[model samples]
Target: MEGRVLITGVAGFIGFHLARRLLADGWTVLGIDNLNDYYDPGLKKDRLAQLEGHPAFQFQKIDLADRSGMEALFAGPYFDVVIHLAAQAGVRYSLQAPHSYVDSNITGLLHILEGCRAQKTAHLLFASSSSVYGANSHLPYSVHDPVDHPVSLYAATKRAGELMAHSYAHLYGIPCTGLRFFTVYGPWGRPDMAYFSFTRKILAGEAIPVFNHGKMQRDFTYIDDIIEGVTRLIPKIPNAQAAWPQDPAASAAPFRIYNIGNHTPVALTDFIGTLESCLGEKAQIEWLPMQDGDVVATYADVAELQEAVAFAPDTSLQDGLQQFVDWYRRYYG
Candidate 1:
């Protein structure tokens, strides 16, 4: 944990937070991000500015799709572990730009895997998503659940990344951990996410979209909880288990996945109500049908994560929303 750690998507919402936490914990971090216009590049740069002040943190602006750049990075001798978080992220955007998912999520991930393999890294922890449980109405989604039918191309690519990581772990004996994150929101959150956009629209006195008639639920995990889980799991890499489930979701290799979530699904209306309370404003609701590539709900079962890492996302909606609202007012006011 003290040695150099390579993090892709260093400027991303989760990535930036994770890097900050790691650096605070005395771990040296090497970060890289494409700074793509998928979101506001200004936000990414602002996040990078914080890391720039850390002596233990070094960052490079590089695209994950750049095979040559990734190769040169891997060719270096400093990285002891790789945490790959860069990807083209949005379920709805995947529908319009399927190739973007392929290029960033698929191609970008392959490069990371290759880099880990070549460098003989100690452990590789990559980001998966609760979206992989698409179309499955099963509550409290467990890592053991079958994720074969992803409703969105984004989800499918993420699931594919998990499988690919498992393959690398099996073939090369590389330690690999995949984190299935729930609805993550907090300070320095993604602008495209519902909570952030809803805050904007509500503050502007504009109507916010209420998908599924505002009946959906999400296990909204806080950023601190997410960072804790990721940090704790860094040292606990998976080993082959003799009693591994025959389920395709289970693997006998040195590959494992855990659902990092709050384990409490709050209704959309309730979530909005919390936001309204935090921001001291009422939102104009615009009811809408479910969009393509969107599931009605996402609930993560973090039992495996708790048993393995001894930690789970436990932050309440009100506390998380208050933190986000405070940051939003300061940043956007």
Candidate 2:
């Protein structure tokens, strides 16, 4: 509790909430984000405003790819841990702009690894995604499962990050925790996400695109559940364990990966129904074929996450969707 933590991507949905939670728990937090216009900058600023006047919080407008800036940040303070949530995110956007993923997810992650190695940070917790379990036919995607078949550029880059982290962990003995998050949604969520956009379209009497003809399903983990799992794992950094094998997925080094997701995967149509129920308006339907780089479904096997962190996402889809709808009305109305 008496330690300073550095969180990259502080302007992002998950990062903002994580930093806020840490600050409230009496942790000194240094938050850094480029505040890119991937979505509305206004929402990002609003999130930052929530942390204003919180004595334990500090903010810096810095790009993760800026190696010098990253080095300066790590050198300035002997941080107890680094929670990296910054990345050029989005599956569809990656198809259009693949270089952005390379610059941010690949280069940016390398910079972070360098910083952690030099500073000897006790632990480094970074974000991964369920998308990495690409093209897998297996149900309830597990951390132990091979994730080499990444279907999207974004997902491939994220998997690359895990490999990069492993190399650094093996060479320098830096403790690294990689969390593969499921479909995270809640208040202050990203506008590019399906739930947020669907809500807006539905409320405005516009048609919401039901991709794959609404046949898809997702393990929609709530934002609060993600925070709970992450915070709980902060104290459980993987160290040199005799039980670990040399498998690339499971590390002999002080590194680990966990799939943090809601075990329940709701069908796309049902999820929309839940949203409609929450907003008191039926969505105008625009059934469409699946877009490029889109998958049919995603489900997480969270037994490892639950066993290791003593946490699992328990928020029901209705409850989480209702919270999002409520926030949307107040924020956009």
Candidate 3:
């Protein structure tokens, strides 16, 4: 189970946690990140700083869209597994910077696919998002659902990445797994995420914006749960099925998708209250109309994930937020 693995967004929230976990499990990891300032490069650097000294961990500064750089990288080493997590992440940012999504999410993914095709990589696990369930009114989004209507450019790019991976898997026989992560939040999380920003605003006695007039719900999967699901999936390579079931999640080719989510949707108001309790403070609410490119709720149907890996996210929001609050106090102080 332990082997040399290449993790593309080594400085990212999930990628950082995954790398640390793999390194601890005795895997030699080559982690790469461009360290972009999409949010705060300083936080990304601090994440990297923690992983720099590990004997089994090595890092390279490379942007995924850099085709020549990626070519040079893949030429040097034969990565048994490539965990592609680098992308232009942010649902709202895509509205203002649409081209960046194409550049990073679409083109960047193409480079990764090409490298994997050339290397004939044993397994390629790439990050997708729950945003792909856009315009689908299903209570618990399932991989079997057709993701044709993406409300945001970010969601479109994610769906495009999934299709691209499927094509590569079919043609090149490269085992590819797409992870559809839900509202992932925890310590060392993205600054753009609601929970992270909420913690900061509440601590500073500022009004936190309550999107959708505080009527939205999200399946806030904790970071540890996400890592555990991904770790279990890394070794479970998909085999090409002789009988095609016409399921979007699986194919006759070596491709599969799974929703790694908590499966428990929490109201935005309730989530904020939990955070307030964790921080020992009250939140000033700024109620606002529903933002464009935003969903009213996200609930994951993790039946396939549980059946495949015999595991699903089970972390409580209260405990997860408490851990994040403790980390925030120590890190910010």
Candidate 4:
């Protein structure tokens, strides 16, 4: 192994793929997840099963909120990098379960920050979301845009994670990078995501609910592209700026935020059409009014990401959705 790394949320979709990739890249990966029943633990276990036999991978069932466990893990070995991807991850669910967001997103992130601060990790890259764009009417969301007005509690907490990370980077001089991921989807995806649920409903010959009356748009980034962006960013540590922007995204500290997204906005109807084409079945869409805490469109301005890593998510929707549909059929059939 070239270096030791810690990945939280290892059983989750992005984390699983990240762990596999890092192991393949000759990194010693220590992965941990609470494995809560947020979705289905079976899916989580199945994701873990893929990495259990890997010689460079180690697994532990530790919650990010667990202070002692996190401290002990950090004390064991100095991680060359730490990727924090665990959180309460739904915009709608926060309405019913707000406390879960606080516990996992806010409090859990505190523990991770403390661990990294103590361990003196070289680079601490954590997951943020494009939802942080909140009620901004901007067409293409940028890292330089003001994110003070978040609509959903989920968005609030993600922004809070960024703030907390920045504080740590400033106080402790840690190299921190916050990735604002857009609507990520691919094989072994989250069951709660619209694309995943839509696939299930379509497979069951039922009408899939089209929120915002099929008028919404999203920068749906593929999971492979998301992981590739992150992988390519591991070695590109941000230096403390001499003249920091007034924007919270960049400061004199080694804290930087990047929007890792497809940058192309697809209308909901067009997305459904692509999925139907891939599945060879027409989707029965029941259009409905826009849901609360949902935006009409999300387009990313990944200029900073491209400038830093020489990469941006560019996977075509047709190609990405076809891979997803193929996996969905094989996984569910």
TM-scores of all models?
0.98, 0.98, 0.99, 0.98
Cα RMSD to the true fold for all candidates: 1.0, 1.0, 0.6, 1.0
Q: Residue 142's C-alpha lDDT in candidate 1?
A: 78
lDDT of 1 by residue, 1-333 (tens): 677899999999999999999999889999999899989999999999989998898988888888999899999865777899999999999999999999999999999989888888889999999999988877778777788889999999999999899999999988999999998999999999999999999999999999889879989999999999999999997888778778755678988888999999999999999999998999999999988888888888888888887887899999999999999889877
Cand. 4 Cα-lDDT: 0.93
- Model 3, TM vs. native: 0.99
Q: Which stretches of candidate 2 lie above 4 Å from their native place?
A: 246-249
Worst 10 residues of 2 by lDDT: 240-249
Off by over 4 Å in 1: none
Model 4, span 1-333: residue lDDT tens:
269999999999999999999999999999999999989999999999999999989999998878888888888978999999999999999999999999999999999999888888899999999999999998799998899999999999999999999989889999999999999999999999999999889988999999878988999999999999999888888889989767666799998999999999999999999988898888888989989999999999999999998998999999998999889888878
Choose the strongest candidate by TM-score. Answer: 3
lDDT on C-alpha atoms for all candidate structures: 0.91, 0.92, 0.95, 0.93
Candidate 3 vs candidate 4, TM-score winner: 3
lDDT of 3 by residue, 1-333 (tens): 989999999999999999999999889999999999999999999999999999999999999889999999999878989999999999999999999999999999999999998999999999999999999998899999999999999999999999999999999999999999999999999999999988888889999999889999999999999999999999999999999988787799999999999999999999988988888899999999999999999999999999999999999999999999999999999
lDDT, candidate 3, at 72: 95
Name the regions of candidate 4 deviating beyond 4 angstroms.
none
Question: Candidate 1 lDDT (Cα, whole model)?
Answer: 0.91
